[model samples]
Target: MKKVKRRAMSVLAIILCLMIGVSVFTYRFFSQGSQWVNFTANKHIYSNGVLIGGAIYDRDGNPLVHTVDGVRKYSDNESVRCATMHIVGDKKSNIATSLQKVYADELMGYNTINGTYSVSGTGNSVYTTLDADICAAAYEQLKGKKGTICIYNYKTGEVICLVSTPTYDPENPPVISADDDNYDGVYINRALSSRFTPGSVYKLVTAAAAIDNIDDIFEQTFTCHKTEVINGQKIICSGTHYEENFEKSLNNSCNIAFGNISRQLGWNTTAEYAQKLGITTAHELSGIPVVKGSIATSGGDNELSWTGIGQNTDLVNPFAMMRVVGIIANHGMCVEPYLVEKVTNSSGFRTQLPPNKTEKRYLSQSTADTLSDMMRSNVRNKYGESNYPAGMEFCAKTGTAELDGSQVSHSWFVGFSRNEKYPYAFVSFVQNGGSGAKVAGVAVTRVMTAVKEKVDSQSTAN
Candidate 1:
């Protein structure tokens, strides 16, 4: 009887151990499933070097990407293929299209029940907020330049146009292994991943800092000699901007005026506002790798002044710039950007993928109003005047950040439109692109026009 009791106890212990082992294995599988799915070679969904996913479509129900004859294919149009290539991604597995790899399971329509052993039928479909035509238009504005252009609705945070230039056709992807002549950073999504120097456009940060910290920020005026000496360090302006007020100084892109403002406000004050505006902060956008923006605040008066005017070690992501502008258009509310609008499984069940908000206040309504007034005047009086349509209203800022040991600067243009029919905020950045107002701003103008036209046509049809 004693021997029988010992046998029962041994069986119970063995069962308990098996249960614990299964629990641990289940935990690891559920938590790090994407990592395991990264190895696409053994996946049954992909055959003959083609992704057998359901499909990826634009917001307008236009098919940007789909599988045909068991092979992944893009739209027949070359421009469309190039425009949405980085966003929808290519079949080639490389470092640039990590977003594609991350969503490989979903693309294969991997299901917990039916897909436990194999992903049967076509994968789930991913429908994004991107407009393929608008994406192509934005890409054309890049004009073979290395840049990123992104636009989203301020009201809903729906990203309409996200294009990265120097892109390649998804159908004929370049070889990554050998010394392929066609490989030209085609897979890199510069809009979300690249970090570039944001020059004068960074003045928006300094201006916001001043507006928030300084009691009489608007009343203060500044004088410049094309260079100002502070703490034995010289701060240089592009040209002499003499006795300029806050509004005129910004419109003129006066370096001396902003340098002085930085000295007065100091690094602490500037950093405070910069954080609020998403500078130097990392944002976790779903399924996309977004680089963080940073400010150099450890230097003396000279460095502080230079940093104030959007120079002296200032690095910003184009996406961050877009969200900052979105905050202004969103009336001081934080706007988290999102791409995929919905995902439909093979069973015909659909799940909406709207942006998740942090409920964090980026700017006060009064401050946004004040800044909007300055930016509104900026569009009318500055470089933006001639580029936009006549009688159309918008607010924008241009940044011409000088690169390290380079003659040309990283040009940046950020803005939001005031049209009730088309409320969009956009950011355009061109690497080594001369003049923020000229090179980058031109692209912004074209993209905004395309979006406006799209809205008008849709409204007319409705």
Candidate 2:
């Protein structure tokens, strides 16, 4: 009787272990089943690790890339193909952030129940919110320059134009040598993947912080003798502006005045405002993660002053900066940017993505309005409105980020359109480009013109 009882106990333990094992397996299958099915090694969706099926289309139904009889094909227009290579991806899956790699499971029509079993031989279709023509125009403007251009709707959160430089045509890829300086970081998308020194464009954050914290910020006045000393360190100005008020100081990009303001705000408050403005945040656009900008507050008064003027250890992502401008344009609230608009499966079923326009307020409406007026003054009084398309209502700030060891400063132009019909925010970065207003401003003008034309044409057609 004792032996039988011991045998029953052993059987019960074994049964309990098996049940627990099955439950864990079931949970993992449900949680991570898509990853398993979409693995590059899967024979159904991949051919030697290259995605075998699916089509990618732009907003205008222009085919950016599609698979024909198990072979991938790109757009016929060479310029368009090269311009969108970073977004559509290459054959080897080198661009990790490409929609092709990020949305592979959906492109392959993978579902927990069907698992590509019901997918047609041609696979699925991913319709993006990108405008191919605008991308092409921006790419042309970026020729021979290593940088990026991004423009998205502040109201709708649709990324209409996103073009990264140093991209090669997928059909005729170049042999990039590691020692070549021109092809450095060719695979990386600067708009979404890289960070740059914010330069004077960071003044917007400083201004926002001061607007909310300092009651007499606008009424403050300072004199620029081309330099100012803070904590035994010299803050140099580009030019002597004599005596100036707060708005005039911003218009002149007076470093001396900003350095003084920085000393007043202190490192802690500056870092706090940077975080609140989304400079230190990592945002995802349809599963494609944007690299976060960074700031360091552990520094002396001199370093703090530099940080306030977008120097020191401050670095910003172009996408995030563009989104910041969008927040200002949308009156304190931002419509989170997104790329993938919808997906259609092989079985003729279409799934439209929900709008990511959350009503999260990043700034007070009053602050945004004040910033908008100031940015408009920047374009009208400083950058020259005649440089942009007529009636663009362009509000912008240009930054020339000084680099280490005599490298030309990076050129940055970040702004938005106040026109109700074209509520777009844009960022243009030119690596090693001198003078943001002259170098990056030219690119912004050309690209925004193209964007305006596209918008006008669409309105007419509708």
Candidate 3:
């Protein structure tokens, strides 16, 4: 009898394990699969005047989209429509970047208990964390450009502004078919999907590795020439820098200095730090799809040197680039970027979304502080302090990322600004643009100025 009881208990445990495995697989399939095309896969349910979903709103409760008279309606503001197309997505579900499709279950107010979503929906609304005004401002600043600009509060992990180009008004979204590249369809979300060469911006990774492994990294000095020859390969920089310390090397954006430093660090430590700083990973921003950053983990001495200076198969997603900068701003600990703030169902049950928390500590607080100081010096010595809003203490790094000889290089600026009132990290990318300082960095001045004014006004009003 005791043996029989033992056998029964073992069978029960096996069944329980199977059930748990099935549950886990189901959850993963839904959440992960929901990211792309699954949300709108059942469009027929919303057809024939059946209310298939709920509304979407900005954090301020400003409505973005809702069903009216059995038809999905978007705001009439063309700028808002164009600026936020990738975030909200159109009703037709043609674009790959449609957030509505990703969150269709919540939008439809699908009830697990009842297993039904009413035609009128449960009035469950998905509140996004986006600020529409900031999106519009970013879009306007990026007019006629092929890049993206993003600003998020690193401490709160609230993405403030996210603007991508090649956008079209949702009200009059054009047809998308084979022969047309998003040049006319306006489907690409450059901020999240596109990857670019980081240029000198990646020096932050090489520098961070050096700091962690090398002794008193700041004390080390390096010499730079117009063209540096290493292993029969010529690495070029903006100009010759006679002798430069860690801070000066960053401020001067010296390629040779950074290349030698990269060689010293080698591919192993550099690759380790890059992964820690999120340079080779796809960031998960729930409902948003960001391409993973790319790098060469192993290479020859000359190849590793160029990789250190932000070249040689090193392609970084713009969002990940901004996030690495944000990690620095947050002193190595950061919150995950969240879009949906809350979800309210038709049953009047409101679920408040928790702040997306980051589980890993990417760097030590001391490392972040040292890198932050170096960035500030870069701003003061290279990018003029006057260029930014007056009295704003900020840090910056400029990247003139090169491409093929046929096209101009990309202009990239990555940095953060913090004060008693505001804590923001930003990245601006301009394709085929001029110098990073003159173009992308200059663009930051007006944007940050506007941000400061708005913050001040809001404070006074409060």
- lDDT (0-100) at residue 138 of candidate 1? 88
Q: Mind giving the per-residue lDDT tens digits that candidate 1 earns over 1-462?
A: 999999999999999999999999898877765555445555665555445666888988788877777767778778888888887777665545444565666666664444423234666778788888898898889857888899988877788988888777777765465555344565678888778778888898888888888888789888988887888878888988788889999888899999888989988888888887987787766667688888986788889988888888888888998998888877788757878777877665673354464444688998887787888889888765767854447789988888777468888889888664677889998888888888898888987887788777888999
What TM-score goes with each of the models?
Answer: 0.91, 0.94, 0.87
What are the runs in model 2 whose C-alpha is more than 4 Å off?
Answer: 1-21
Which pairs clash (backbone N, Cα, C closer than 3 Å) in model 3? 51-119, 122-346
* Backbone clashes in model 2, listed as residue pairs: none
Instruction: Give candidate 1's whole-model lDDT.
Output: 0.79
Tens digits of per-residue lDDT for model 3, 76-184: 5677777777888865665566667666667765544433445454446887778887777777877777778888888877887787876777788666676764454
Worst 10 residues of 2 by lDDT: 351-360
Candidate 3 segments exceeding 4 Å error = 1-44, 47-52, 118-123, 175-185, 351-356
Worst 10 residues of 1 by lDDT: 111-120
lDDT of each: 0.79, 0.88, 0.78
Candidate order (TM-score): 2, 1, 3
Over all chains combined, what TM-score does candidate 1 have? 0.91
Clashes of each: 5, 0, 2
